[model samples]
Target chain A: MQWWTLFQKELIENVRNVKWVWVPLVMILLAVMDPLTNYYLPQIIDAAGGMPDDTEIQLPEYQPADVVMMSLGQFSSMGVLVIALMSMGVISGERKSGVSELILVKPVSYLNYITAKWASLALLTLVAFSLGMLASWYYINLLFGALSFGALLQVLLFYGLWLLLIVSISIFYNTLVKTPGLVAFLTIATVMLMGLVTTIFSHILEWSPNRISTYIQQMLTTGSVPSDLTGAAIVTLMMIVFLIFGSVYTFRKKELAS
Target chain B: MALVTVEKLSKKYDSSPAVSQTSFQLTSGKCVALIGPNGAGKTTTLRMLSGLLKPTSGTIAFAGMSQNSDIRNSIGYLPQHPVFFKWMTGKEFLVYVSRLAYLSKPEALRRAKNLLERVGLAESANRRISKYSGGMKQRLGIAQAMIHQPMLLMLDEPVSSLDPIGRRDVLTLMEELKEDMTILFSTHILGDADEVSDEVLLMHEGKIIESGSMGELRQKYQTAKIKLGFDGDLRDYQEKVTALPTVIECYIQRDVLHVTVQNMTAARHDILTAASSEEWPLTSFAVNRASLEDMFMKAVNS
Candidate 1:
């Protein structure tokens, strides 16, 4: 009940700050804009490039699944960056603002506090990302042909797991670092490095948590789950669990000086 | 009668001690002031007692609870600069902290209203905390601390940041609150301690130098001296005053005679009688009593 109350406060804070409105707007804009711009790229190019007579420009046809994949790509880079920046101050901001001192001095459990934070961020991530992807799906079906809804759903489930991983990385770093700026920098840098390292070593690193990203795109493009999806999903799930516990453990020390 | 007992309580940051082996006991329903200069570890000791900071060593047993037993539910703490969610209304913030203190929602709401009224903020309960003045914020801080009706209410410099009027408002509040719960507050100003505290824990250099009731402390350290100002040559009365059996020593400086006396009652009688009989020109006579500041200076200097 206490954790629920605290979680309610977090959600109210998100509402008051307009994070609920603005974050999903940014995400949906990133998702749908990619497809709309791609569909009109030829016209945009022809207008900009005023050829003297007849100029033939060859542009590749965009499939609905491919455009959705392109939107996911934008999410992977820009969406992940936005999530990292937005959630970077989850723990550190409270500590710096001295609100944690007021609450922690009560008989509240450190684990419950951490879980409440993670759960709220997870809810926000789920809502915003789902709405953003649905908007992107609408535009893709409208401009490009209709894609498989079942495929999009499966891809969202996997990619939602991936977004969960990113949000956990953010909160986990929030617990470790005191400055929100440092938390954002470190979380995005670590996630990007994990993505880079996993791509270079995918042949050997089948179990890397970063593989969930590729699994997300692969699941979206092809209608079948990859054979290695179970191993990567398990590894990523274990990491999320570890990050939650790690957050709880590290957050215990935050009140030592606060 | 001891509500809180702390023994050898110490807290260190890195290798340097902030509160060094401090021991003290707070009697039930007594307002105990932790008085010290800046960097004297009063804040550190209060933080450890309130469970905001863990002590590097020592024990704090509240209401006879053993070490390691959680005393958070029984103690209320207001930090030196109490921080609140600026977005929350005063009543809402109180309700929120009351819930954290384990009150049910309905009970929290009731107590939130009750406390806001008690703190004289019922009219402004719906105003956001960002709009509260320094004094109002401190009052709201105290209301939140007391929402659960804890046995001990700990305030860290509750009035240190307020304007004169704000300071008076909080001090008056503290004076009324001590009737219900034990209050352990910290301040560098000895005058505030003298005004509201029944007992004082005086700290210097992170160590407790003196701890006693206000009356007992004054009795122990009170100086027996009198100041005499004369209209005539002050030297004329110095010798005559020192000759009295109660007069232990006498000296004149700047037209005033300072006399150390063995007894105030006896000295007052002898000096007045001699002045009347001898027709000595005596202008004023006053017996000096040592103040908390004097005692603090004496302790710090020693």
Candidate 2:
């Protein structure tokens, strides 16, 4: 119950957070952006009711869920943005404010402090992801065509996968450093590595799961979970591995000083 | 019973020791003040005792609990500088802090209200702490600390940021709280410690060099010198006054005279009678006792 109070307080703080306001605001904006991308984009390129491409104007064959994938791209970008800003202060602000000393004297555990952060960030990702999903279905049905329920489910699944990646990365940021600026920088660097650098790394390192999330994004857009499911499973496991190691490494040795 | 016991505690960053082999014990219903110069380990000691830092060596026992986590449950700490989330309102900050201190739902809300009111922050409870004055923030620190009614309350330089009125308000609260809990606070200011401490622990070079009840310490380091002020020039009767068998020393301050007799009780009457027989029109006379601040300064300097 005490742990829950701390968690709830973190939620309220995040909700009231000026930065927190941007989270939902941006996500909802992405929500608004999803349909806008589906609607005006084709018309803008065509100008004469037909888009100008090398061959002809086509939206690269959107799956019933491709609308969702585009929406995922929008929301994921927002997630990365919000958590990046949030990650900067994971432990740094507390050190500055001396709240660490205030909380330490309470029969509060190091686990409590770490756990509160984990819970708070996890909740933020969950709520934002859920909001994105709702927006994804509404946009696709309204702008694209008749509902493809299977594709709808696949898009929702991708939202989960993407959120898992972001949460893991954010927690890693929280533990590895003390300052918010460093946290933001680390998060951006890690994302770039996972999204882009991993492609190069994977070629040299044969068993790298680094580019797996990008592949998952590809599969979700096509409305297929993929044949083996082995690669995706391994990649998910790797994220957990990174999260466990990162969480244990930094949090275990973190000096609870204010 | 000792509410807090520190043994051979030390903290060092790189090669310099911030606090070294500091040891002390505090019991319920008593207020012990830690007085020291800046970087004398007062804040470090308080932080360690509050479970904020890991000591380089040794142990701290709080209400029979050796673990910091256990100690934290029973103690309330007011840090030297208090920072709120800035985004949170005063009520929100207290709600969060109160909950962290383990107050239940209604109880947390209730405690937050009561503590805010106690600190005279009820009107500003909805205001953001970033808008609060320095004194108001200090008051908030105290209010948040007392929300759970912790058995042991520790404050580190709490009054350093407060005005005289604010300082007086906090000291009066501490005096009122003495009946039920143990308090151990640290400060560098001599007058602050002199007013609230039942006992004083003097720290220097990261070590507790001297400690005792204020009276015990004052008498232990009694000075032979006494303050004496006369209606006329003391030099006129200096020889005669010094000739009195009971008078050991005297010094004049302004218009009042203070005489220190060799034996205060036995020679007090004789000293006065001698003055009367001499036809000296003495305006005032009293025993001059040593002050805690004087003893503290001397101990630290020595």
Candidate 3:
């Protein structure tokens, strides 16, 4: 019951701040922009008018699945950053402003507090990502061709987990830091470092959460599940659980010192 | 009856202690003031009691509660500088807090409305908290703290940041509140403590120096002195006042003659008789009772 109240407060704060509106708007724009730009690439070049008049530019016919993957590519970079920045202040800002001090004084448990935050942000991210992906899928069918609905659901499931990993990482860092900017910096840095390591050591780090994006792309295009897909998904789920527990532990120890 | 008993409650930061071996009790229906200077650990003590900070080594046991049970259910705390959800309206904020205390939605709304009216914020209940002035915010803070109707309401410097009008508003509200539940509030201003508190805990340098009822503290530190002021000069009347049989010591400080007396009643009669007979130009005469400031200074110094 206490967790429900805290979650409602978090949701209301996001709604009041219009985070619900802008985050999904940005996601939709990123998603739709991919298909629209890909479909109009030749005309865009013609409109640019910078190419030689006699030169002919040949472009490949993009597949709907490829366009969806392209949108996911945009999401993994810009969309992940957006989600990270949105959740950067979840815990740190309340501690700095002294609101946490007042709230924690009640009969609320530390686990409830941390879990409420994680659940609220997770719901927002999943909802926004789902809306963005569904919109992109619709556009992909209309512009290029029809992709299997099963593929879209699979992409949403795996890709949403990766995005949630960003939210979880952001929340964990928020509990560990007192400054929102520092939290944002640390969260983004962690994600980028993981991506770098996963790229350089793909074979050894096959179970890495960062590889979920690659497995997702493969799943969408070839309709073949990677052998390490289950491993990556399991590791990602374990990391999310560990982060939520770690956040609760850190928050209990810190106790809103400011 | 004692409602809360805290024993050896100490909080240490890294190497330095913010509160050390402090034990105190809150009597039911009494407003207790935790009085101390800045950096005296009053805030730390209140935070521990509210369960916002863990004590370094101590046990806080409330009446009728089990050893390991959560004491926060009976406590409502307002931090020294309370920051609320500025985007929330006053009524919405109170309702939110009430629900956190586990009140049902309709019950929370009813309590929120009643508290807003009680705190005199009913007219502005729908306004966003960002639009509230400092005093309005303080009142709203008090209202939220009381929404759950906890057994004890703890406020850390509830009025320290308010202007005069705001201070009076909070003080008056506290005075009314102490008639029911126990209230333990901290303040550096001795005057505010003197005005509203029934008992006082004087703290200094991370330790409680004195704790007692307000009257008990005043009597413990009482100097039994009489202050005399004159129109022209104190030198003329100082010698005469000192020669009185009941006067023990007489000294001039800041244009007033401070006369410590053996007996207050006899001293008053003797000094007034001399002033009337000698026709000395008397400006003011006051029988000095020990103020909270005097008790605080004596306790801290001792």
In order, the candidates keep a fraction of the true contacts of 0.59, 0.86, 0.83
- Runs of candidate 1 with Cα error greater than 4 angstroms are A47-52, B228-260, B269-283
lDDT of each: 0.86, 0.72, 0.88
Q: Which order, best to worst by lDDT?
A: 3, 1, 2
* Candidate 3 structure quality by residue, lDDT tens digits, B37-81: 999999999888887777899988888998688887788998888
lDDT of 3 by residue, A68-166 (tens): 878988998899889888998888999888887777777788898888999999999999888998999898888899988888888889888888888
Worst 10 residues of 3 chain B by lDDT: B293-302
TM-scores of the models, in the order given: 0.93, 0.82, 0.95
The per-residue C-alpha lDDT of model 3 at residue B28 equals: 84
Scored against the true structure, residue B225 in model 3 reaches a CA lDDT of: 82
Provide the clash count, candidate 1.
0
For B165-232, candidate 2 gives per-residue lDDT tens digits of 98988888788777767888889898888888898899989999999888888888775445555676
Error of 1 at B269 (Å): 4.7
Candidate 2 residue-wise lDDT, A1-258, digit = tens: 777877777787776765466665667677667567667776666675653346654466555545655665665566677767765676656764566666656666556676677768766766666676676677677767666666556555645655666666767776667776877878778876765655666665433444444555656555566643446556666775678477757765767673
- Docking category of candidate 2: medium
DockQ of 3: 0.75
Error of 1 at A148 (Å): 2.3
